[model samples]
Target: MIINKILNVDDYYYDVFMAISGTLTGFSANELQSTGLAETYYKHILGQIETATFLEFLNVSKSILENSFSQDQLRNAIQSEIMADPGMQDMSNNIITMWYLGTWEGTYVNELSYKESLVWNVMHAHPPGAKQPGFKSWAVQPVNSNS
Candidate 1:
């Protein structure tokens, strides 16, 4: 089905994208938006997938958002509706990888993507060369963040 026939891409596509992304990544929409790569990643994913497939993914995302009530329900819906679909597997993997590693298809999307990669946050560290702590800061033992 042609996407534009039923849904307006220019209006709510990104919102749906963010919602689905947040569910898939276990991050809040606010945290994902804080990276400043929402638009960048949205456009990038759109470019990477066939329009028909991408639209279906968006529709499923919207459905998942509207129907899911709790965390388990959301995750189950994603696993069944999104991950189980053969057509969506590559794109689903890409979204997760993109959010965590800041790469699409194993390549960095951009410098900003690298700088703001979620992996660094998960590790409680900064991306190397993206942010400088200070001269000789690394020489000092890093504090145990988990303590």
Candidate 2:
């Protein structure tokens, strides 16, 4: 049950998390796995959040995504789930933030933490001000880097 220990979900629901999170954040499941979301966020940050809210968020999110296909359907299911439980919006946002930013504030309701963000990896681009490789070198194609 190490997978459950790590992801806080049964083995079967692992794919559910992958699908919902990937569709919601527009990242591939492989991309998420590459960044170690289960170890960093699920076991650490999510484990520290309000247990009921976090668990409910997972349960409801999985339920919503179960019978859905396409990005739009996934979005709708998440929206419906959020409507059913307003607090889950915060949970959903935090999850997305965790994937893209690689850190969670435990419901502080603030901007995402991009210090160790996976977005930089997903985008195959630099974070502009953070830590750009070979500064002003113009070697890598700048997605948002200003000259």
Candidate 3:
């Protein structure tokens, strides 16, 4: 149930990602990668969830990251969120799978094998080239999504 709630929050984040990119015309792959929107979008989701005490509902100990949420649980939450949207359902497995691989093998994996590779590959390929305008740190840090 807590994962479900988290998934709902992630779904909102995904929607925001789609909305931001959808409005762009001739949005080159480089531009998409350089925009660093996914990182911003994820942080926005975490902020909303934290502000709403969504994690508190899970009763996870704040001291430990692994104990707070197992990798499988996180994967399921992401998959569930992706599948709930018509536009994302078809790509849910690819998205979740890539995130899994990226987390485990490092985002620099040279042999990615999923459509979601496009997503992570782009992020990895064009990491935050310069400091993001409003944020204090680079957007594409390794721990961005894990938290």
Candidate 4:
């Protein structure tokens, strides 16, 4: 399985890659652990790295999946980019987490009530719960936005 293959890799970069990929693809850790796609994805990620930078690999992967770039083309691009920026070899879990958040739109979360948000926040930060604390105690107010 892809998740197993990724988990087996001792490198932190591979771990971060798997995390980001799972987040982007909406695959839970359990799902990834059970499926073959995780390994396929990991191998694809390995093929994309030349100088072995996490960010470059992520950029290439994002372009391939999000912008519809071909896997081979994206891999080559990442290889050259990594060669030029050798300092990008490390991966930051926080950065990957943020990337995952930005990539995954939270339409449902935004519509949640304050109480719901609290419940969801306790279970998971994303997809905030629909009810808010003291929902019955507060008056509903409207705010203006330029958008």
Candidate number with greatest lDDT: 1
Candidate 4 displacement at residue 114 in angstroms? 42
Winner by TM-score: 1
Model 3 ranges off by over 4 Å: 1-68, 88-147
Candidate 3 minimal-lDDT segment of 10 residues? 57-66
- Residue by residue across 1-147, what tens digits does model 2's lDDT show? 011222446655455566667766887666677654444455554457776666676677676666665657766777777755668777777778777766666442223335446778767766677666675666655667686
- Reference-based TM-score of each model: 0.83, 0.66, 0.19, 0.31
- In TM-score terms, candidate 4 sits at 0.31
Which scores greater on lDDT, model 2 or model 3? Answer: 2
By TM-score, the candidates rank as 1, 2, 4, 3
> Over all chains combined, what TM-score does candidate 1 have?
0.83
Residue 106, model 3: lDDT of 30
Error of 1 at 19 (Å): 0.5
Per-residue lDDT of model 1, residues 53-141, tens digit only: 88888888888878888778888888898889887877788899999999999899988999888888888778877787678786777
Error of 1 at 5 (Å): 22
Against the unseen true structure, what C-alpha lDDT does each candidate score?
0.81, 0.62, 0.35, 0.42
Off by over 4 Å in 4: 1-6, 48-147
- How big is the positional error of residue 100 in model 3, measured in Å on the Cα after superposition? 14
How many steric overlaps does candidate 1 have? 0
Residue-level lDDT of model 3, residues 73-136, one tens digit each, is: 5445444444455544433332333333322223422332222233444365322332233544
